[model samples]
Target chain A: MTAAVAEPGPTDAPLLRVRGLDKHFGPVQALYHVDLDLPSGKVTALCGDNGAGKSVLTKCIAGIYQPDHAEFLWEGHPAHIRSARDASRLGIETVYQDLALADNLDIVQNMFLGRERTSRGLLDEDSMERAAGETLASLRVTTVKSIRQPVASLSGGQRQSVAVAKAVMWNSKLVIMDEPTAALGVVQTKMVLDLIRRLRDRGLAVMVISHNLNDVFEVADRIAVMYLGRLVVQGDAATFDRQSVVEYMTTGAAGRPGGPRAKES
Target chain B: MAGALPERAPDLTAAPEAIAAELPPEVVAQSLGEYVRAYTARIRAGESGVLPVIVAMVAIMVVFEAISPNHVFLSPVNLVNLFQQSAVIMVLAMAEGFALVIGEIDLSVGFVGALGAAITVQLVQPLTTNWPWWAAILAGLFACAVFGAIQGTLVTRLRLPSFIVTLAGFLIANGLFLKVLLLGPFSGYPNLAGQSINLQVVYYLMWGSIDPVISWIGAAVVVIGLGLFMWLGDARRRSSGLVAPPVSLTLVKIGLIAVIAIVVVGICNTNRANLGTLEGVPWVIPIVLAVLGAWTVLLQRTTYGRYVYAIGGNPEATRRAGVNLAVVRTVAFTLCSFTAGVGMLLYASLLGGMSNNVQGGQYVLYAVAAAVIGGTSLFGGRGKPLHGILGGLVIGGIYNGMYLQGLSVEWEYIVTGLVLLAAVIIDSVSRRGSSSGSVTRV
Candidate 1:
């Protein structure tokens, strides 16, 4: 095991920097030498159509699958994460679109599912409830009427909030959310977008995978477009319009030349 | 411009608080009804939680008592008898609960229990006797433990379902039981008569009395200790910024325990006849209580307990959690079989000897029924050993009461089947309600 080296100085280096990452499933390549940097305190949107390899790249970073070849740079030094547990231990929490919340368990139980506190050799229900309440409150998730209510009773938007809060509760520096606003109503979508902004404002890096351009425009600070398992363009959110991103996402190259393409994109 | 905006609200309205206070009674009632609807909806969504099953159990008991004459069905002696008879069933149910908690089943409990008795008798008799009674008992238990471990390893390492593995065990164990029984019927075994062990030991444990004052003190101490542990634990957890059950819920649980203890003691103090004194706690009661405590702790308090629940809920999730699924699952099966072994020893003592042509299959079925009736989910990821005790007691009560009423054995079987079916149906309905509305959180 190599020693994990922290980057020098605060606000000096990107939280996560993936370089020359390649992944293959049998004969077909899923991700082709993808390179991207997720800086601290910003929401970076990874957008593409179906089969753009967004899910594949997200899973690799989340440690669900090991990349065939890649270097995961944490801070300024390369890091190796082999499992989801390892990623979690390194303060990287991923909230997949499914959320992975147990339906039978209530809000608090779901929030602390795997990492429950024990006192005197039993589940410390009081402590868990209080902590859950505090975490939800801190995240401004007030739509939930009761923490004791089962997660099944929660609406789609509330479930998303709970999933985010669960990740945030662990002091996660990098939170990856896969299509957080998918399959939600207009009101619910707005609530989730607000949550994304709140996560970034807390000085935490966020990587959001979404097909909804409206949501991307509302919350993302930076955009990375993937085409054919490779990031074709990367730039400030304010610099690119919807038409140019759509063009780049559908084609292998961006519309403009000598721009950020196939280099740092 | 003002018309287009529908005019801003006039400032002449009463304070906002006054407006809320003036809401209509019908509207408030409707809102209250909605709240209640939502609460019930949530409860219905979680399929395996405790409340719905508990309510059904109470309702069943009430209905039975109401339809019976003189409420004789609810008499103190009958209740005590119910507890006594349920002892074996409770032990067996707990054994099954352990297996079910890890999403498995133990089908060999009946034969395993018989095996324990057969071994105990053989060791204690003159034919092959070489050890004291205590040593023999320990040896019998050890043998069962080893047997359990073998079955567990087979299922875990070979990736076989426990149902199939234990079924095969059931056949092998029955053969062993028969072979051991035919080995010349060991003689001079303290109290052996033909094919039976002494009944005196069973009577002593089942109906023997302890000192009244001592029993009261013991019961009181237990209740107080439990209450203190719960209260203090809750407080400590709350202080540490963790989630805990409501304080009200804890108090309710403690109160229920106290009531149960006091009532049990009161029943034991009651005498059925003036000619013979029948007052005091039974030895088996304490033994069963001890077993319950130990097993409950094993399933709820240890890392092993977490692993079992995890495996039951989601094997994939547990695997991702870095738990060795095969090892934990096999250990659970082993424990289940070992407990069954203990139950068999006690059962033989109750009967005075191992009887020929024992229906091991029937007994195993009863054990499974007791567990399922007690609220343990067949699909796994939910259940506690405590359910075993409650379910066992209910079954035992029905058996004792029916026997007292001069019902035939066949009738008893029918009644047990019906009751088991009802309990299962209720469980299924409650589970459907709960799971549909909410996602099951670990």
Candidate 2:
């Protein structure tokens, strides 16, 4: 593609727009006509009870599952993400809940796990170490003792930081984190929430999946709550309070019989 | 789930310079004293690395030297013979190291290796194929690699357990080895003692020695090269503000290498012959070292090696990283078998021929035992080729010392079995102390 073709589309458009996404497994429907918008430089929290289709939608966007019907607009252009590689090629990176880090490898090694840089058939350790350090520093993650420390030695927050740093280091335009702080302690959860805000401040589109509403309110600029395989409400963080969001999460609707369903962006 | 806000959110709006200034040092210190303290802390944390293995090795050497009949275990002749005898198992351990690092085991390496040795010996027989020594060796290694690929494919593609696949491979290879030895104009064995210069070179692989002068020169070159490589690389990383070992640590490591090389060469250069001047470094010693050096680089400096470790630690993570798990696993098996071929070639040289009577099963046990005793975690993702070398030496020392004491083969098995159990216990205990205890598999 030429330079002109490289520029995706208009700058102000949402970085990733998902419309009418549907997914099913045999006779069961997991996600139903899910509509979502992930704007750049903002954090959009995805909230749902278990099996409420939050993960199913994230996996669809991550190219881990083939949606039965979906329309994707990546960076303001119609794009197809058929594989995880395809999503990565489009500058979309996912930090799964498991963290997907090799425990035996050091921080730098885990950061550049698959896409390791090599020179003359040898791993360029110096360059990787420098780059990983710079990325961590940019994220203001100074809690870890050393980048060379093996991942198993890291605290839960430090591991999450490494995972996020890995995602952001790939020149990613959009980052989707699945429950970034599920198992973290108080201080560790604070560290990861701060990291999520930093990603948003860096002007990257961030989609966070979390069951913890406190973490959601701490970093999320916009929140989308799902129930029974449907997006009950999607709006700015200011539009909904904790009780409203919780009600929407469990009952598929907030206040009244026909309250605000899909508020204007 | 709701929770209270943090007591104080760290200042995210601070300048980059401010954050950098508050950052902790990558290493605890740059001086020798601080370096030792950090090392002790790490060891106490259960990341003792090769220290335990080295200590175990020294303990083995000391005990054997003190108790062997006439104290022959420490004699120069016996030491050199021990080195030669240990060569094959050391290489086999290295072969197993490849598969072990990838969280798999190649139970077939012993027989796979014997099959390769059989092929090499058969081809080099003047009355038969009459191939050159080098070509025959390559062919034999290739045969082993092919077998590895076949077994690897079954394990990776068919999703069969590696233990079962390689165990079946072990039986098939044992049968094939016998059949290959009986091919053409041979009975049940192929001897390497013939009128061919190629055959002589192959024989010299185990029985011959380098000239004293040449051995000294080679030792100097190796020591200097290795020392310079380590010192310069670490120095550059330190200068560039990267994570590197302390200057004192690098120098100490280099010094250790130099001391080891000098001692080994000095002992090997002395006259050990009761009748004539039959002293120099054995050819097999360098052969084993060369394999160790090459495999060390492959595992440490290559992307494939990184993937192997990653896969071993967490296969799902590796797959999520877009690494082809099947390909990496298959290649690991291939390299395992190929290295085993090298070990078997050395085995043939030591025995002076290839035959069906080789104890392939016992050798496989020795291979696993060596890797484990050398501090390689059987749980995977924590091993090195050097572990195989140290472990191999321990196995060889025990075997030689038992022979010196006139112990039966049964004792060798019993002692090795006990040693293997001790190693696995140490591994499991240390892992529990350091990380999450998930030792459900051997």
Candidate 3:
């Protein structure tokens, strides 16, 4: 990890808050009263093993899957996200694991997509292309030679960047990415980590769900550990190391009464 | 957040630093030569464009010429015949192209075209209250569009398979064609036996021509207009820091188009007229050309076209993008049927009448075959209108060539079937290479 971790500044308010967020599938509970906070201009890493409810929490915020019960507060104002459209309307965007980009569309088309810039009766291609070029440049994503090349032709890392750019293209206040670097190589992963940091530096709240602890440690400022459908612990990233996260992920025993790190704390 | 600022904030307006300043930007075709090389590599890698069909067309010409007892393949009269025959199929193929590009099939296009012709005839003939020429044609076209919308709605709203919906549409339109043909003022003609009818205007679309001087002038304007647009558009793209094909390439394209246009017009200008010198290309040529040009612009330049390609490539993704897939998909079918109506006009003109025995099934098959043969994928997400021209030419060429050689109808069917199979095989194989194989990005 190159950058030091920091807690949310005292003056900063949480951009989004999830309290007692519970989701169940049939008889199984995917999330159990998970509480978390994402403040403006910081990165929160959501860590968990496969069934620890990371995806559920993300979907809840994204409005892809409604939580069975939860109080979702947006900028300290309670807001109900009933659909994906609602979440985006409230300036929340998610980059799904699959990216969900149209392979046949070029960068400009993919970026503007549902929100194309139309001048009069026709597509304002010049304006849209220029905007796309500027957006990529602002994000320092210059891997692609042309904004007109189809997303199908991009590398995994470049595709992830495009997805991230798409998430941030609108006036999104909070961006959640699910396993963005899972399909990338070493260099690509590094590129994405830099992009995440770039997003944070732009004063946007970012939440990343990642299995890659190295990447989480590299970019995440706040660490929230999930275990068995519950938020076991959360703190400044400095409070945990790779070993500690692994222990919490497996045993859910970070700082509970009489637990492993409780005595030391 | 202050501490997290990049050590060196990127100059957002400065020249973009590519991922690797050394290697080629992973996705651009930087120059004309590079574009060609990449294109060839893509073709070899099974991203089949119109290249294969083009080669096949040339081969068909050569083989037919070599095998024929006479110079029947390139005879100017036969060339004109080929163009006329191809017009209907080309229009139909263009119709199928819209649906196919969006990962759907309109099985009803052929019959829909037949019904259009039937309606046109019914409206124009004195057996009915004689409607004017343009009114009859417009009414026919409108009816066809509405019919298509019905099927499109059924498919999109009900989430029914387009193939099945349009298959039902095919049968319905087929029966409707007969009912339109056998009954009422359609073709009973006040007392004569039920017979086919063709309006002079309908017939003249294939048989008529502009004056030679006017044809030559129109040809010049069109060719020059296309060249200027390409040059200006490419230059505009370059100035905006976007990668455009090299000027040389644009010039070469213009040159090639000019050359092809010259040859075709020259052939038509020859004294192929059996009666007093019927010179100049058929009026239909220009109409077809205009249709192709307009469609190219629509597909390449419009938001609707973008949505079609996007839906074909990834329906879920397009939906996620907040696009109403139903509306886009439905409008696609309507547009397809509208084009099919245009093809029906051409067919009626060519056959000199709208006949009850209009082989609607066969027409739809040929339409799909032409689209696929021209390199539009049946698996979807990739295609162009230009492909209809190439594929229709090859299709019309085969039928004309075989007839010139005195081949029987059965042989035409056999060969058409074989050619269609070859095209589908190529599509499937190429798709696998591009989508599921080792060189995914290629």
Per model, the share of native interface contacts recovered reads 0.12, 0.47, 0.36
What is the C-alpha lDDT profile of model 1 across B1-442, one tens digit per residue? 1101111231122232222222222111224454344344435443334554476557646765775566766777666766777888888888888887776888998898778767776666644553455666777777777788899999989888778888999999998887777666443223333322323333354556676677899899999999999999866754553434456556767899999889888887777445877777777778788888998887766667766877776676456545688888878887888888777776766665666666778878788888888888876867888888878877776677677667799988998898789767867776565443224433
Q: Is the docking of candidate 1 incorrect, acceptable, medium or high quality?
A: acceptable
DockQ class, candidate 3: acceptable
Q: For residues B60-150, could you state the per-residue lDDT of candidate 3 as single tens digits?
A: 9899888877777887888888999998899899989999999999999998888887788777765564677688889889889999899
Top model by DockQ, which number? 2
Summarize candidate 2's per-residue lDDT along A182-263 as a digit string, tens digits. 8877877898898898899999999999999999998999999999999878888987778888899888878764445664
Greater TM-score among 1 and 2 belongs to 2
Candidate 3 residue spans exceeding 4 A from truth: A1-11, A22-30, A255-265, B1-27, B185-198, B436-442
In TM-score terms, which candidate is top?
2
The residue-level lDDT of candidate 1 at A228 comes to 84
Put down candidate 2 lDDT per residue, B12-34, tens digits, no spaces. 43333322222222354567786
- For the record, the alpha-carbon RMSD of candidate 2 to the native fold, in angstroms, is 5.1
